[model samples]
Each structure stands twice: as structure tokens, then as C-alpha cells.
Target: MSLLSVRSLTRSLAQRRLLAIDELCLADGESCVLTGENGSGKSTLLRILAGIDAPDGGTGCFDGRPFAWRPYPDWLRKQVTYVHQQPYLFHSSVIDNIAYGLRARGVPGAERERRVAEALSWARLNHLLDTPPARLSGGEKQRLALARAWVLRPRLLLLDEPTASLDADSRRQTIELLRTFADAGTTAVIACHDRDVIELAAMRRLDLVDGRIITD
Candidate 1:
């Protein structure tokens, strides 16, 4: 069964229609790579699904429950996570940043610490646990953001241009991390043009054109 399903989704900017999708579905544990030209609405679609932006019109089902945009169903919020090209980080240490979501969700201290430690190792950030986010390199920061979300163990993850600004080595590291996530059964929809990401063994491709998914 699909974990997410949307129908007749649409979005506009002033009079310009930014996105229009007749339907889109993702199965549990699926990995999808979104491809399109710069203005083909890749990011816009990701933002809408992430609930960071609302669609002009649409209906969705997540985990067999109704989903919404304006209020962004509270239950869905706990099940989906989004990370941008330039992720926002706390002003504190790496460990603290990864623990923020857990703390907010009222996870017990012992369990929180355990998850944070696992996340640190997952992102290969264990050595930098005490370092502030500001001190990290671009790739490191992106890893931190992924780790932050990973610690929450959200059922779905939406990533927009996650490797857009990284060097080759960093990009490779990021891809490895994504592979780890996929291995752990975390569903993902990634917007990217990188051939390596597009060719990931676990990913199926979706191409957006003229504000619509032209290929799947």
C-alpha cells in the first residue's frame, strides 16, 4: 500500500500556475528522485508536500489518514520531515541540534541521548558533537541537518537540492548518508540534478515539466 497519495494538486503564483499534478503516490520505503529544469516547480512541489507551503487546491492521504495544507495535520507533522538546500541549524552544539526535535517531542532523556548518539554516528558527526553548527563546513552542516531529521525517525523525508552546493567529496558523503537512510527504510523524495543521486539503485525517477510530472 502507498504511504502517500495526492490528487488534483495545484499551486499558483499570482496568475502563473506553478504546479499541477493529477496524481502522485509513493510507497512505503520507496526512494524517488525528482528531475526538472530550474523553474519546473521541483522545489515548489517539495515545499508543498513538506507542508512548508500550501497548495492552491489538492487532497491527500498519508498513512491512510486525511492530510491537509493550511493546518498541516498534526499527525502528519510527526511523520514527515523536510530539509532545504541550505538547512537551518541551531546556534548550539551539533549534538544539541540533533536533540532539539526529540526534546520538543518530549522524548525521555535517556532515549533522546541514545538516538542522538546513533544519529551522530549515522552522519559521521560523532567527533564534532561539541562543535557549534556555525563552525561546520557546508557538507558537515547538511549532514547535521539530515541527522537532526533522522533522529526523529520520520516515516517520510523530503529533501530539496541537498547536494547543490557541495564539493565532490562532500557530495559523495551525502549520497552515502542517503543510502544509509534508504537501507533503514526511510521513504524519501529528493529534488536534484546530480547524476549520482538520480542513479541511486533505490530511486525511481520523476520528471517535472511545464509545472507537471511528465514522466514517472
Candidate 2:
């Protein structure tokens, strides 16, 4: 069975249907690049999958267990990670920020540091470890967010336009990091307008139009 499955999913706000996905399934270690225009429900689907928002009506299964429309269980929440288009950075050093999630989860001091280090290596942000968020560039901040998520080692990584406004070099770096995630067997659902992200080997393309998936 797939690690994540959604059946008859629908999300509506103020009586307007935002999404109506009949079925979607993601096997463990699989990844999909979600392409859609603004307000086309790409972000909504990520939010719902990440369990940050509840659907209007749906049946979702994680690891073969069922979940109704509501706040997710602690374990389920831990299994999903969502990075915003403009991820919020706390007022702190880069390394400190990356280590925040593990710390919150009460991961041991040594383990947190170790995982943070691994994340730095994964995102290639080691040099920026000690830098303050104010001093970092847009791409650096984006990388920092990705590293932060990496440290948690969530089962499903949701990225919302992670490379949206980056420079050429930054975009290249971001794409490389995503490729590393794929190589490591991390299941990721990336919602973006950039086709460059589709170059990742694990990524299968899916388009969202008028709140419905148009799979080919």
C-alpha cells in the first residue's frame, strides 16, 4: 500500500470548493512535482497533506491508517513537513534555527547537533551556519528552511515554490539539494511553477487546473 493516500478529498472555504481530488497516492520514497497557477489549490493540497489544514470532506490514510478531517495526530504531524514560499526565520543564528525543530521535539542535545550538522551538509549551508538571518540572502534563507526540515527527517516533505524568487546560482543550489533528497529516498511533494524542479529523477509531473488534477 502507498504510504500516503487521499480518497474523495474536497476542500472548501466560504462555500467555494478549493479542491476536489478524487484520489491521490504516494508510495514511500516516491516524489511528485505539483505544477499549478496561483489559487489553483496547489498550496491548499500541500497544507492539507501536511495536516496544517483540515479538508472539507475526505478520507486520508497514512501508513494504512485512516484520518478524518481534523487536526492530525502528533505522530502524523511529525511524518509531514511543509516549507512555505517565504519561510519564517526566527531571530537567531542559522545553525540555531536549523536545530530548532529537533530541540522542540526534545531530541537529545548531542543528537540535535548531529542531525543539524548532517542537514547543513545536505543543504550545503555549512558556511552559513553562524550567520544571522538578517545577513543572509533570499536563497540562503530558503536553503536554511530546507535544512531545518531535513533535520526533522519527516516522511513527507512539502515544498511550496522553494526556488520561486532565487537568483541563477541560488536556484541551481536549490535544485541540487532537492536532487539529494530524491537520491536519499525521501518522499517529497513540491508545488512550484518552475519546470527546472521537474528535472529531479524521482519527480513525476502532475498539473492542477481549476482545483482538479490533470494527470497524463
Candidate 3:
């Protein structure tokens, strides 16, 4: 069964239609990209799927259960995570930022430390462990954002232009980490135009036109 499914989805603002997806589905461990021109509703779709925004109309299901995004249920919140193009970070140290979610979820202190250490190594942020998240370089901040989410081991990840403004090396490192996430069975939907990201293993393309999926 699909991990997530949606049909007859619609969204509009100020009397302007934004999305009109007839049907869409994602399988467990699947990696897909959302491609479209600006205003084509890629971010809008990601926000709805991430439960950050509600659609005007739609029926959605996840893990064989109805997706009640309006109220944004606790179970779904625990299962899904979203990262913006310019991700947000706390005014705290990198290690603390990475441990924030685990702490909120009530993960044991030792386990949180272990996971934060693992994440730091995984994202190559060990060197910046004590640096303030807000003072890090763009790529460093992005990696921190990803590491923070990855530590939670979410089943589904929604990323908006994750590689938008990075240098070549930074982009490569970020893509490698994303590949690792996919290999570990985390379903991901990334909105981006980067060639490296588009060509990741087992990555499928979903092109949007005028807020509708033109090809999948």
C-alpha cells in the first residue's frame, strides 16, 4: 500500500486557484522531486503534505489511515517533517539545535546525545558542534536543519529547494546526505531544479504546470 495518497485536492487564495491535483501517491521509501515554474504550487503542495497549511479541498491518506491535515494530528506530526529553502534555526549551539526535537519528543538524554553525535558526523558538522546555528555559513545552516530533522527519523520528509543557493562542494555534500536518507527508507519529496538532486538514485519526477501535476 502507498505510504501517502491524495485525490481531488484543491487550493486557492484571493479567488485564484493554486492547486488542482486529481490524484497523487507516494510509496514507502520512495524519493521524488517536485518540478515547476514559480507559482506552479510546488511549495503549496509540500506545505499541505507537511501539514503546515491546509488545502481548500481534498481527501488524503497516510500509512493506510485518513490524513486529517486540518487539525494536524499528533501521530502525523511525529511521522512527517518539513524543511524550508531557508531553514529556521534556534539561537542556540549546533548540538543543542539538533537535540531540540528529540528533547521535545521525550527521547532520553543519553539517546539524544548519541543521536546528535551521529547526526553531526553524518552531516559533517562535528567541527561546528559548538558554533551558534545562526552564525554558520549558508550550507552549514542547511546541513544543521537537515541533521535536526534526520535525528527524528521521520517516515516522510518534505524539503523545499534544499539546494537552492550552495556552492558546488556544499551542494554535493548535501546531496550525499539526502541520498543516505533515502537509502534508510525515508520517503522524500524535494522541490528543486538542481541537476544533481534530480538525478539521485531511484528518484522520480513530478512536473507541475499551472498548479496541476502535468507528469508523474
Poorest 10 consecutive residues by lDDT, candidate 2: 195-204
- Worst 10-residue lDDT window for candidate 1 reads 195-204
Q: Candidate 1, which segments miss by more than 4 Å at Cα? A: none
TM-score of each: 0.97, 0.94, 0.97
Q: So what's the TM-score on candidate 3?
A: 0.97
RMSD vs true structure, all candidates? 1.1, 1.5, 1.0
Q: lDDT per residue, candidate 2, 62-165, as tens digits?
A: 88888775767787887788999988899988888999889878999888888988888888787876788878999998899989988888888999998998
True-vs-predicted CA distance for residue 48, candidate 3, Å? 0.7
Better of 1 and 2 by TM-score: 1
> Over 4 Å off in model 2, which ranges?
201-203
Candidate 2's TM-score: 0.94
| Candidate 1 backbone overlaps, count | 0
TM-score of 1: 0.97
In candidate 3 the C-alpha lDDT for residue 22 amounts to: 98
Residue pairs with backbone atoms closer than 3 Å in model 2 (clashes): none
